[model samples]
Target: MKIVKRILKIVIALIGLLLLTGIITLWLDSSGTNYLKINKNESQFGNSYLIKNVNIIPMNQDTVLVDKMVYIKEGIIKKIADTIEVNGIQIFNGEDKYLTPGLIDMHVHVWDRYELGLYLSNGVTAVRNLWGMPMHLRIKEDAMADNIFSPAFFTTGPKLTGSEFVGDDNLNLSNPSEAKEKVILYKDRGYDFIKTYYGLDKEIFDAVIEQAKISEIDIVAHPSQKVAFSYHLNPQIKSIEHAEEIVQQPLQFDLDVIKLQPIIDSISQSKHTRYSTTITVFNNIYQMMMDDSILDSESLEFMNPLILKVDSENQFNRWFNAKQEDSTTVSRIKKQHDFHITIVKKLHEAGVTIVCGTDAGIGVTLPGFSIHKELAFYKEAGLSNYEILKTATINASQTHSMMSQLGTVEEGKIANLLLVDENPLVTLSTLKNPICVFVKGRKLNRETLDSFNEKAKNRKNLMASTLRYLENLAIGK
Candidate 1:
């Protein structure tokens, strides 16, 4: 009896040790070390889908499906068919909602801490931040690892620029050599791409492009003063920010710039290069500063309140509509905008892929809701509704090289999807009514995204308001 008691005590102690070890291991794994999140064994709601009932929209033209049920497990679509023969699997009735890939906004900014909440709220599962703060990147890293709730973030880490006014918070590179070094540093630091801001000289831009290509990084450029529009023809530069051809006024200097159209077409044709046109930026800027009446428009509902709350405080105010007083300047800006639209039309005609991007979280471009505005602008610029939708959905996935895992709702794809109350096919603006969003099969409704936003916004607004008050205090009335 004594021996048996001693053995029992030893066994109990060993079991306790094992249990403690397991808990510690799980805690570390869940401590925000990675971006991949998994939500398992949840009941599916919606149409009782069978394999044959799942509709697959392969962004690629080669494969397609219709009316098939898809089986999802471990955060990925396991199979599709008229019927899946798995037992104890939850079925999500996907009949009411067409399963397409989660929308991608290739060009966006998330400087505000609460920006991620807005992105998720809009059913944007993946975003490529052209420029981002280091702190945002860290938070993104944590969010990816399930440490916090956020979108899948990929960014340039910092802007390589010479302008101090680019933003109060930006990594400034004064020279080409510095720019090259910065690109490598960011690449080493796990940045997804290289972003060049305005003011870098041609030499710096070229150097940055060369180094970026060599480092296996995609180079995205904003309209820089020092570089001519012709630079985009270079194969090394992969994508151009804001419509590449529109921002620059037509210059008559003795250079081959007239050939810009052909070069642009060639780059657009290149499988290696992609274009992200943030037309919403142009529309908003023109409306806010040029027309002034856009501020009072009902469309501004899509704008983030936080951005409107802080615009006066951020000094990089590049908001201005060109005054027609100088006929030449106004004509030039108008001509340029027209030229950009023409180029997009030409590019589309030539089969060059275009990615829909909204430069949200910067200046007048609002978060969460700006994407719909971008589509509207795309339509205004000559693209049909189908083309614009493809730009935001399927084409965007291809631009980011995420065709397999993203950009479509199909078997063997991540179950990141959006369910809208209305059909977005008829009206692009209806994409805003997101009933539910799924990131890695973890379904979040409008309420979830809104809840996250409320929590994040309260803290964020407090800080912003405090800063504003301090700035006024510093001015001493």
Candidate 2:
């Protein structure tokens, strides 16, 4: 018995040593320049070049071909088309490549640390996170401070949902006063906006909107019967997400249409608020409910084969199967899809402010890949290529209030841009193959971004394995 006890003690000590070592390693890695943060001053990795003579796809204005050299000095576009005398400026021949503003994915769940690098690899220079955890807020701060090499971030920290909203962990404000208090708290916390999830009651929603408006914070609401079109177009909520939620099915016009139409017209023209229709989510959920062959047919070309590998893995399959079989109550996701497109078409016809967005990193719309899928859905909704591109590029920037700096490539705009191998005006899919991404003049090519992701992937795996080992030790297995 004494010998056995001693052996057990030794085993426990060894386990403790291993755990301590792993934790220390993880911490060191986190603090390192190559991990969560990037060393911005390091010039050994970047190109010291003038990309001259590339066709520019200025999203807001006309495409131009003024032969000019773009100079990169310390990761910023220092000059455009300037013929100043500079020595040792390596030149990248961009005679064939096309330059446009860097893509902004307005909606993403980059809560997972690796997700940001993945987005960067896909040429997404900025992301407007609808829901952000505390960790996400920290990472955003780091990125903004230039400590982290990540896309520019804007967020509504966590989310405001009602108790009835399913399968989400968000701030549930039950009463009108509670809603008001929470909105004030969020505004004080420096959130870019208030992201409303499903199930907010009329009273609570109204209080939130009133409080948010007072706080000078915008509200991005998910439309429903509780917070439907009439409520949205009015003073409280401004924009609706997931098109169907805004105006799906028939509603009795018991309210004055005379009063409503003018209000709607005004909202359509207003720049203060806009819609981010994450139609990709609707299509994903809709295909699962009905036919999925359409999804396979269209998405096969754009979606990364790696994503399919992940989905096919037994772990994800089991999770997906369990959710699909559970039928306590399913959303009118199909009706919502049909209704949403119809309404969006109507909005476009009426010249309403429509911005393109995809709820990427959701269940199926994997990050980096979902942007293209979203544009496809927009096209299916009858928007032309130019219109669809506008939503993803120009409209997204306008929605996030960064139109002047980041939306389009112009003389005075911040040099957040993309150089693609093909003209995106002819094919939106060309955006998926970004040759280079420039954020505030700091450029990163596919190779550099991919290297970052590779490191992150290894770290994620190592962390997972360490946790599993610790779990086994806890159970004495």
Candidate 3:
């Protein structure tokens, strides 16, 4: 009995010590955190503004409205007129710059506040976060309240990974009843959608889809390995992620070009379903495989320290240190990167909706900057610049039913706009550095945007974010 009592005391003391450490870590993380407050710009135009003599690309169509005036009131675009007069609100001289609706990255994995600015700095005004946590909901709430300078944030619940525990971003549920319950719980918790992952078996996948349909929520398909590719072509599935996933899951990593056409035909027939091109994911793999020193590149400094810490298995180190050349190389990984480009081009020709996305949070797809490269690949795939912009703008907005509120620069719409120095239609490179971006009504000008980018480069709040990430794992429970 004495020995038992002594052991119990030791366990209690260890628990207490751990709790104290967590408190200290959170305190340090919140210390000197002035960078989170991003609305430091001198705004004579407080959520209401007038722009004179701007060329509007609108993005509802391929035409441009030259030398127009736009009036915004309380974060809504009141009117876009050839000439307009307004008083009591600030007026910005457009000076003939090209103004368009803000870009929408249809698929992303956002882990921290820093990544929010990365998207905005790159002119991405809205994002659909794929693997979500309770922390994401808090971030969305804060962003809406203007407490955090962020894009229009929407997220799914934790990924429904049945029978497999992959990483920190997973909630494994093999039971069908449990899967249905999670759908309801996520909906009640205010998650915008439910995300399906690779590990889910057919039984669990069916339950999730049925529950999502009954609950009237949306489903975003990431391809389930246990099920065939055609299984994800359900009417309830809104968007399919990653062109490479088509190879990974549906094609089952088969490299036969002969077998590819039939699957492409089936996808082409699913007219209502939208697809996101995250070729950057495979491109990252190819680069890591080929380049000896790419893992230590300077671009990775901007990655969230929490993500860098949590993926402790270290995908970069694994790829770099692999005994074989590079696992993703075509000789080993099957279909070549050029073949992936061909797949994208075929999808475009089939009149499929191709949305712009970069799986930016992981491995070397730099958040703000990498979208341009994805667009360049689309260019190589034979999409005109207008069609490429549409993937990130109007086409993207339609996927989430946000077109009523955003997706265009027209009357009676929320003001999410990006102003750039050059015509994006002529040169897609102009989107890489937007002169200014309007999030809802708040404006982030060049200098303010630069500051946000700089802060994002510095890794902050490592321990605190990791603890929060752990806590978020049990959100549905």
Candidate 4:
């Protein structure tokens, strides 16, 4: 009896220790001091500035307005004209430079706050994080309050899935009531949207959608394998996540472009439907798993050390071992990836709205860098440079329902703009580096942005790394 009592005490003590550790970790992760907080000074925040003699790609059209001056005051674009004589305004000589709306990555998995600077440095001014945790709410609040030098942030609640869940960030619903209850909980918690995963059943999916409508929130979904694809194509879903979801449908192969006309038409006609093409992410994984030389070239400097460790132990290990045992499986994945690219082209041609999204922070898709690669994939899929840019700018803002305030550089819009050395419409490569980025009217030059990137690359300490590794393990990542 005494032995059993002692064991029970030990178990209770261990549980208490774990609970305390988790609370401390969450506090640290959400603290403003741990992130690159933008000092809210008069010069950087809520200040008036003018960029003189610049070319503007407003992103509302395919044309550029040349030799114009843009005036920003109090985090808003106050005016744009050929010339503006404004007193007490800092002036930037934008001679031969081009200004465009900041890029947005519509789908990302944000694991840590450090990646926020990485995203901003890559010209991504806004992001829609697909997975949400308690820490994310704090991050969102900080971003919205302009306390952090981060992107315009939005996030969905934890992913809703059925059985076969792989991580702790998912709510596994076995019935309609559970789904409805979870939706209400997340809505009350202030999550922006509801993210549905692949294992959900038709009944549970319908319940989630209905509950979300009642809660006045949006639904972002990956078509469930258990449900028919047509079910997910309803106008209720805000965005369809991956291209594979559409490509995996049973369609007769034909050379005629009209073969996919019906599917495309349905998607185009839907009131609340946008597609996020995460092609670069899948392609990155395929290259790393199939080609040894390619894997060696892919750098891990910018990736979170904890993510890398978890991936190396789980996803990477599985792929590498499988490739060594059977090359045929990897070949099949490559073929599937090519098919996904083809489908993306067809969707673009059919006038379906495409939003740029890189499934970054998962495997090898580094946070900020993957969006640029996604744009390149869109180009390879036969989209013009202008069209590809739209997926990241205008279309992305539209997806997030922030078109009025974002997606374009005009008077009365938020001052999330990027100034590049060359014309991005003519050459997409110019967007890979920005001369300066203005977030909410605060200017960060290339040198300052580079410092942010460098800090993230070398920010991992031994204690944090170990804690993160253990956290990922506990969550089954």
Candidate 5:
């Protein structure tokens, strides 16, 4: 009996030692700056630049303002004219290049601060993050003040869900009272909005909406199929995510215009709620369905390696395993994707507001790059380049009520602009590769942008991610 007790103590001590070692490793990993914030001071922080003879595709209108000299000072577009000689500012020879308003990605899942530079490199100057924690509020405050490497950060609190709680990151509210409490908690915590997710039922969903209204915070929903889709169309429910969600829930796999048109009409008539186009993400699912080999996309290099490693067992593995399913599923996914495009077309025709949202940082939908792919899909939906740009710029800003300061290239606005070689209004692909991007007047030219992508592909941060996950869990974020 004495020997048995001694053995148990020895075994427990070994486990404790191993745990301590693991925690130390994570702390060291989080301290390392291998991947996150690689561009901390790479670019000189300057809010002034002169672009000579550039064509401006100011998003407020479709036409390009040709051969204009634009002046930016203190991070604001100071003036624009046919020619202006600035005494002190550095001049960019933008002859024949197209300058436009920086893009806004309304729906993104930003994991690390490193991802902020990725967005800027792609001419995405502002992002509205769908998932948020306490860490995110800090990121937002930092980015908002004077972070050249980061985008203008707007984030919702950690998603609220129902008891089933499919996602680990979400706050699962077991009852209506708990749902109401969390709404206040998130608002008080300084989250920009409250996001409710799929598992939520009618009672809890209503409580959330009611509480959000009382808290004076907006509600963005990934609607619960358990509740009628129409239940989420209230004015307080600001935006509904994912076109596939609509097809699955309210449409119920029915492509019939009779059913679809009514939903579109109701949303348009109300003129309050908006839809985010995550069609690229759904199309990515179809691509994964068609080819298992696609799991090894070179572009995945830009994503956080730690996320890629875990997703290998989680999201990546699920999709890769799904390739074994028969061809019928693939065809069905293709059909659903087509319907999503159709839904967008009908909604646009009905004058319903649509914002561009790539469910980036999930599956193989790479951030920064995915927005262009989403625009390509919108092109397939018969939207013109100007109209498609609206989804990314004008509409996105309008949805967030930031049109005064953003979403257009105008004198006196913040100098968040994109300069591309070819005209974006003529060929949207030019946006895929920007010559330079100005994020709050901090310019990152192409060479510096390439460095951001390269660091992401080469670095790994497993221990850092584990530490973050633990923190997020402990904080109920």
Candidate 6:
């Protein structure tokens, strides 16, 4: 009896120690003390600014209003007229410049806070992070409060997958009751949305949808292999991620484009269903697998060294080595990319809403840089420059349900504008470099933005990176 009692005490003591360690780790991770620190420009919000004589691509229409003056005060556009009579306002010469609504990347995986500046420097004014944790929640709060130099941030809770995919960040539901419980938990915790992963079963998916509706939350998902593509096209699901699921449905790999009409029609008719074109990330993966490029030209210099090292040693190198052993794998990936581009064009032509997404922070897709590459892919897929830009601007806002205040450059809307040297409507590449960006009415000039880029590249949060590397290693990710 004494031996058993002593064993019980030892077990309890061990459990207490484990719980204490977990709490400490959570505190350290969520505190942001280990994050890269960037100096914030001391510009007061609510200050008046006048941008004179610029051409405005309002994004509400496919036309440019030339020689216009935009007046902003208190983070809102007060007027966009031929002239505005105001004193004690900072005046910026917008001569021969183009002004447009800042770009939005609808899907991203945010691993660190420093990536925020990277997004803003590249003119991405808003982002929807697909995966979330305690650290992400804190970052979201900070961004919303203007405590950090970030884009308009939104995030979903940690991914809900099946037990087959095991990870500390993933909620692996085994039954309907568990699914419902997880949904409610995320809703109460203030996650912007719920994200379902690839391994989810149909029964759990249905439960999640029902619970999400009850919780007044939305769900974004990748179509499960266990379910039909049509199953995920329900009105409750906000958007479908990746092109592979849709492409795999037809069975015949080389089917005529005409045969895809029925599928396209269904998607267009769903009304609530939007597709995220993560084509550039796939293209990046293909290039890496084929040994064509070590890293994308745009992402080479700006990616965090710790992240680059882990990806090179684990994800990219492994895939590249495997592809070399089997040349057919490379061909398959290339074919899939071709099909994805074709489907994007078809979906756009069919009047289905397509949101710009790059699946950045995965593989070779750099945070801020990949959004431009994604836009370029849309152009290559036969979309006009205006249409391609809309995917990241108007369509993104609509998909995220922020259209009332975002998606356009107009009076009364939040002042998130980008100034470019050339017309993006004519040359989408101009978006890759912004002369200056106004995030929530606070202007970040070229030099300040460049400083952000330099800080992000050089400042490696070793503690955070080491923790992440250890976690990924334990999970064999």
Candidate 6 or 4, higher TM-score? 4
Give one digit per residue, the lDDT tens place, for model 5 in 1-477: 999999999999999997898788765654553433424444365677788989999898889999999999878998999989789668878877899999989889877766776887788888888988776887788777674367778999999888897678888889999999888988888899899887888888889988988988888889887788888888788888999887888887887877899888887887888899699888987777676666577877777666677763376566656656655767777888998999999989999889999988777778888898898888999899999999998788887554458888889888888999998888999998899888778778899887777655645666666666677888955
Instruction: Arrange candidates, best TM-score first.
Output: 3, 5, 4, 6, 2, 1
What residue pairs clash in candidate 5, if any at all? none
Q: What is the C-alpha lDDT of each candidate?
A: 0.62, 0.65, 0.82, 0.81, 0.81, 0.80
Off by over 4 Å in 2: 1-36, 44-49, 71-79, 82-91, 163-168, 234-238, 247-272, 286-341, 452-477
- The candidate that wins on TM-score is 3
Encode model 6's per-residue lDDT on 350-406: one tens digit a residue. 898999999987777889989998998898889999999899998888875644577
Off by over 4 Å in 6: 1-47, 249-259, 292-301, 468-477
Which segments of model 1 are wrong by more than 4 Å?
1-54, 62-64, 162-170, 174-176, 244-266, 290-339, 402-404, 421-427, 449-477
What CA root-mean-square deviation does each model show from the true structure? 12.2, 6.9, 2.7, 3.5, 3.3, 4.4
The true-structure Cα RMSD of candidate 3 reads 2.7
Q: What is the TM-score of each candidate against the true structure?
A: 0.74, 0.75, 0.92, 0.89, 0.90, 0.87
Which prediction has more favorable lDDT, 2 or 5?
A: 5
| Model 5, runs deviating above 4 Å | 1-44, 85-87, 319-325, 402-404
Q: Provide the global lDDT of candidate 4 against the true structure.
A: 0.81
What is the TM-score (0 to 1) of candidate 1?
0.74
Model 3 ranges with Cα > 4 A deviation: 1-21, 27-33, 38-42, 164-168, 310-313, 323-335, 474-477
Any residue pairs clashing in model 4, and if so which? none
Worst 10 residues of 4 by lDDT: 249-258
Error of 3 at 107 (Å): 1.3
